[model samples]
Target chain A: MRISFSTTLMVCLTFVTLGCNDDQASVSLPESAKPLAVDATPYLVTTEPADTTPVGEARESLMDGESATLIGTIGGSSKPFIEGLAAFTIVDQKIPCCAAEEGCPTPWDYCCTQDQVKDNIATIKIVDESGSPVTADARQLFGISELSQVIVSGTAKRDDQGNLTLAASTIYVKP
Target chain B: MLLPWEYGVRNLARRPIHSGLTLFALTTVTLLIFVVVGFIRGLERSLAVSGDPNVMLVYSLTSEENIENSSISAQIPDLLAASLSATVKHFGITHHSPELYLGSRVTTADQSPGLGLVRGVTPTAPLVRRTVRMTEGTWPQPGEVMVGRLAATKLGVPTEVLKIGNQIEMEGQAWQISGTFAAEGASFESEIWCDLSDLQTATKRQDLSLVAMLLKDRTASSEVDLFCMERKDLELRAVRESEYYQTLQQHYRPVRILGWLIVGLVATAGIFAGLNLMYGALAGRIRELAMLQVLGYKRVAILVSVVQEGLVLASAASLIAGTFAVCWINGLTVRFTMGAFALRIDSLAILSGCAVGLLLGILGALPPALKALHASVAINLKAV
Candidate 1:
């Protein structure tokens, strides 16, 4: 009986020792990949478009694959700039951006006017030759932040739900 | 020749105190397994059954994942009802419920204050939370409140404290408990519910926590999503209620894993205890076993008798433990951060406990039996 008990205890101790050693083994982690670089110089325009349309009106009127020159402020969601893609949502200038009126912390999100903000905001993506948005953060490419008014000349692509997306050929950053 | 099965039964009777001790040890271990497994099953079942796939929750994005922390404009429900009239309406009335959910200290007449989960809901709440049914009394009238079946357990008070017509106080106002409700054993059974507007008036809050709507079908989720997308001003995000609870279940995966580990450890200890008890019992019986071998019975026959003795004891232990768990432990209320749930010693817990008991008997007997049988009959008989 004593011998049997000793054998059982030794086996349990052996298992516990093995389990403890497994926890101490070192693990190697893989390196993170570098971010993709994109050039926005070709699409950058020094002069604003001659005929500009409000983002709200353009959202209502533009059909898919139609050309449009929409003017708007760089404000809608708190983070309007899309990460790893040269795309941003622009809200129509007609709706206030909450900076002056409400002293909202993330006035760029236009949260105070969120009810009507949807129709007034349109997504603008600077597409490359292959028609996919540039593989870089829009903030790094455009040097623009929330509440900056700009004009974008692009082809409007409307999804089935009538959400407007502007494939920009030119973007005029307001001084 | 084989020893009669009666020999094993007779051996157990010869050492009543020893056999009873082994039975007690085995029963205790099996009962512990039931308790741990019951906790895991109860917690999982509470979360799993809470979510309804066809129901959609619309809450402010600011609240992140917790719907209780979410606060949306009170008018949003009406706005949804008007904008998506076709989707929100079933027959003639709308199917949306704007609610106010929060945790607050509540006091019963006999009991001191205890933290309780409270929900301010309208009659429309039942339209979306379809599992809810009035177990007793009617829907809450103006100042009256309705209590969930598990509300008393959650509040750490006697069940009588929340009986229909009993008065409870919260938010600095005393309110009568007009009724009791059950949410099909869902987590909602731990909450105290009252009229939404009355709660708002008491709490002095104008905004609603979230709006839950019953969609026509699963595909109708997209329409609600589109509404949320278009009305960006609402800052509302829509999610399937089932998906939300599934995420909560995923969040609690670590706790369930810990429960399983505890069951494993306890069963391992029980097996070891069984081994020790069997070794002691067999040591004194070695001479008897060798005498049986001399009496024209094979060593395997004596070994089978030893195992049969252990099996009988373990099985009796399992039956006693299982009966005790079913009668006393099942549906025992357990309070948690998500409210309270009943410890479920359901079919699965009972089956697992029985499996452990049988495991203890077979595994514990085999090693010691083999060790005793290794000695020759001539050496064993001469010793005692």
Candidate 2:
């Protein structure tokens, strides 16, 4: 009887002590995940991230049916600026040209967005409808700032002026 | 007692071949059960670990077979923002990011072509899969790509081959590597990333694979569910990202059940083999057991001794097989249709092996013990 009691006791203790879960990692959702009132504000929609293309380079490729996220400032005083609610400009990144840093393709010649290069700074316009900028709050559509890190996805089209025009399908203003 | 527990060990030493065979049988059975059950558990765990409860996956109602097959208008996020949740735009804290997925092929540096999954994403893709960290280099550019570390091995190329500055091509277009990312074992590790536009042009696919959304609140999933249910025009579906993998776990139940069946069959065979050995060995010991009974050893005590012997053998086999599983088989990676999962010899598996040993002990000893107990001392004396 003593042996039996001791055996049962040992077995129970072994189970209780060793059976603790090693991977009980509680997968809790983020605090922001708690259900909240869906704020009915003009919002940026997100999808799974796609590849990133510089705003300037995508303008050059103008591949038909091509869409991508353009990562750059939406509106800036340095170069790119919004024309109206429906039209905005993004600055293209400059590549160093032969140590002189002066060699960049003509900004007006790119086929993705309409922009101008002055004093080595390139700026382009993002229009609601390419070559036909309608009246819309471009500032409200894409928050303007040098830090307004914006990402937009769309098809590449060329305006009659041999300028790159991106018909944006999705736009995300950096929060 | 006629034979103390220590004598069980001595008895085993006496019949080397029979005891060796019995031990070997239990070892095989125990190892089989551990591996089969361990594999299922690993798969369930790896999938479950990949999702977050607050994140949601939205795809077209027409989506089936695989995520890459689903296509939606790129403007769906704008539509969802307008109709489903307004809080998404609150405070300029962007929670909605879109993703495009494509099933494409990769040609290795060795010129070997193989299947691969490509995801076109914005910078926010890593933010949604929070564990992901860029281990090297900057984010990708138009002519550049970021490779997931695991994706390298899955693509039949050395992981080092995917380092920054390396080149990989798909759909006749070449992409230079810009960086590598680690996602803490998340499924995102098995994909190659490129700009959404370039992927669309390269593959000629204008539709999206799916969109992952961080909700305004936890309750948004229910709202999203209701929205999907009601919005047939959109032909959309909404589910919590974490719960989606649970559905996948269920979908793979047949594979688990099949493993269990194999374990059950082999374990049963082990039990029968053990029973035969016990019965034969005990038949020869009946006279000795009868003599001990005549000398005042209770039949119950003798029965306990036989069971104890069986338990000891099972315990030994458990130890040997458990060691083998932990040392040799643990951490072995198995690739599934979705991704790879490594087999783990964790606590649960060890406990499972112990339970098998206990059951094996009782079943192996029971019949022979009963036969010994029922034999009369007079019959034994006359027969031998």
Candidate 3:
């Protein structure tokens, strides 16, 4: 009886150990994978087409795989200013840490502040005259910031840079 | 002046083999019960101690998994942090730190891969979690990282390997390792920390995974929960750290129940064996019992003596079992799903186990004792 009772006890303990081992394995993740990101949205557009262009005229031209005029805002940059067109958002930014003696004046030393844009990069997004969205590669595009408004007349096509290319014939900032 | 129990002990010694077997059975059961209870209690205590009441985990309202699948916008963290600080201050809370969490990998200087919970924390995070202590090195600098001891060990790196001057890469960004900390016996011991902004940029995450706050009084946990939930602007849940662990205990309930069920079944088998052993002792000793009755001893005295013998056996078994469990099982550490904890083996668990053994002894001996007491004096004397 004593032996049987002990055997039963050992069996129960073994089960408990197995259960715990399984749970431990499940809670941990793999080493190579990145942790889950909290942000849900992966894409955003900041530009709008020029107001003077005939709305359907750009849409119809792009429907036949032809060039169309488009305009949009420029968002992010590593540097303070750029002369050409690009697509980006105007956000207040700061670096979290700085090398200055009194500390950097920015809210953060590593990144810029949020909701305010300090500089202009000429990154533009082209939209059809009907205001429907068009896909564009952001790296090759140039001048859209929260502060500067621009009008451009160009032939829009998908470029090798992965941005919707508008070969600009006329470009001017809205005053 | 001799006590009845002393006489009973003398009688128990006369039948060494029978008494020893009964004692052994009781001892085995007692030890099992004590060890099992201690294991459960110890794990519960460890869980409670590790969880901080001030911290709240926010998972997706839809799925109960980690926060990765949750889709709250990136801007919500700043907005919620401002609101929580104001609300918590009204209840005497002075600081709140919001953290974004992602699970990431770290490779030591030797290139051994280690898994870590990458937490994106503000500088104020240390203030909110006072239990987290820096064992060596300074706090995290922007673009720099800190790692836990367990993670360090897993990566086969020295604690100083990730110190302030070292640089490590993650998500294509080279971050300097600035500090090391230990949260002793907590899940945090398995994590890595970095500046909130750097982690966000590295992982391309803009939303906060959860927010944790420190309160003025520990007892006001419920109030804080209510306060957070009452706000229409922030849809959130509040649970005390203790209560959260209690809920987590649900995960182990099935195991606990299975343990008890097995114990109960084994105990029943032990009781039956004890009953048979007691019956055998009575049957074989009928001539001795009859002689005692013929020698002018009262039937009740004989019955009392028999019951006393059983109690003596049980008490001896209880002592042996208790001693063995304490020496062998107490403080034994076992790793479980959450983490590792030690077997506590407190006084109460030991006492309860002994009590069960004593009760089984009485139950097994009672029937035979009563039957011997009711035998006719004349018949017993004739048989003798």
Candidate 4:
């Protein structure tokens, strides 16, 4: 079939435009940058798997220093990791960071010398998976800044004054 | 009582130089308007179609302008992403990639300086946004980079120059250029991408500038908004990708308005000049019109013929102007605040120019044509 000059020009232009778009669509991630498969078993925390009626009840059910998987969203900012447990809330015994006037710096920054440093630590109102409130100590464990999905494995402990705290020995992040 | 339009055409033909000059002036005005309007429309189209809607930009509330100024705790992204996944999953959001953007001057091994927008993106970013096309090599490795088409062109860097295994320095840190990409529009066509961690370390930014995520459904803007609002601690605003471009255009409103004002002022002058030209043509042929009047041609008929002459001139001028604009302005690249955009003299732009020309012709011819038609038939006959 014979095509006029203008028709041919238009055809070429259309091809060029489509070709440009197709070329752009093929951008690939570098082989080295591809995400590696993470072990989900290590990060699986079975504590209070189902939604509880209260927030802190999930933590109260755990025995002190007993291994329980804590499933929760990653908090703070940092590199992606499953084991990095920046912070978590236990049941009741929630100490408001404001009461840490005895030189407790914010948990984010540990300034032991400053009387008001402890005031900077975030205080969590511990509640069970059920609607009941429980007592727990707000413990700062691993520091992972970037928010991510995670499951932490740790032992639970209650401090003097009936404040429960989780001493995490091994933490896993669900990939 | 009818006067032939052929007489008006003949009058115009009699003084070819004056007709040519008037037509040229009209053409210039029409061309300028077409080019300016076309460019604005083209830029709007480019920006609207550039990026993916699924990509959300998470910048600091305190930091305005570029994302580079914003800083969050380095762990905030991972934490936020984890906490928000359930809500994001409820809305069917699949890919959430955090990006950190930093502007730095890059240099080749030979010390040639290249200005670039260095973006630190996740591996999944390319999967979410299909517009980013890589022409050669591969995506950036952990410490490697990928350059955009225009950036490569400007820096005179060949695809081969970015060896897959070689490192280049930017801000005293060495990074390898592992790939190259080109996009549909101009903005992304002039940038460079790298690994988020690599750029962060290079810039010494322990915190991410922003996080981008793609929604499984494009219509989930409201859902995303609700999710962000529910988590008052997150403190984010969700905007559609298209709406973001609209907001960007808002930044250029003053310049666009100024451009329109200039075109309007010039067009007004052209209209006046067109009116004078028509008046001169009619006055110079007063005897001819008068003879027609004495021969029983109605005054309205004479007026119609004069107006027809103006239309003919305008039609000719419109064609000339449209042709000039297409040849000179179409696809011509000009720099702007955001970046460079090519002039696009599409059908609408050309039609608007022609419409303006026609309107000018009618308005310019009305008074002169009426005056000629209103002259006394006897006086016209005497003059002839």
Chain A accuracy as TM-score for every candidate: 0.76, 0.45, 0.29, 0.29
Q: What is the lDDT of candidate 4?
A: 0.59
Choose the strongest candidate by lDDT.
1
> In candidate 1, what are the lDDT values of residues B77-194, reduced to their tens digit?
8888887742457668788888999999999989578999999998888988999999999899988999998998898999988888889999999999999999988999999999
For model 2, the chain A TM-score is 0.45
Candidate 3 chain B lowest-lDDT run of ten: B226-235
What candidate 1 gets wrong by more than 4 Å, as runs, is: A1-175, B85-88
Name the candidate, 2 or 3, with the larger DockQ value. Answer: 2
Give the TM-score ranking, best first: 1, 2, 4, 3
| Pairwise lDDT winner, candidates 1 and 4 | 1
- What DockQ score does model 1 reach against the true complex? 0.04
Per-chain TM-score of chain A in candidate 4 equals 0.29
Q: Rank the candidates by lDDT, best first.
A: 1, 2, 4, 3
Cα lDDT, model 4, residue A141: 24
Docking class of predicted structure 1: incorrect
For each candidate, report its DockQ versus the true two-chain complex: 0.04, 0.04, 0.01, 0.03
Which parts of model 2 have CA positions greater than 4 angstroms off? A1-19, A22-175, B64-66, B78-93, B110-113, B133-169, B173-184, B222-232, B378-384
Q: Chain B TM-score per candidate, please.
A: 0.96, 0.84, 0.68, 0.79
Let me know the TM-score candidate 1 reaches against the reference structure: 0.72
Better of 2 and 3 by lDDT: 2
Error of 4 at A98 (Å): 27
Instruction: Tell me the TM-score of each prediction against the true structure.
Output: 0.72, 0.65, 0.51, 0.60
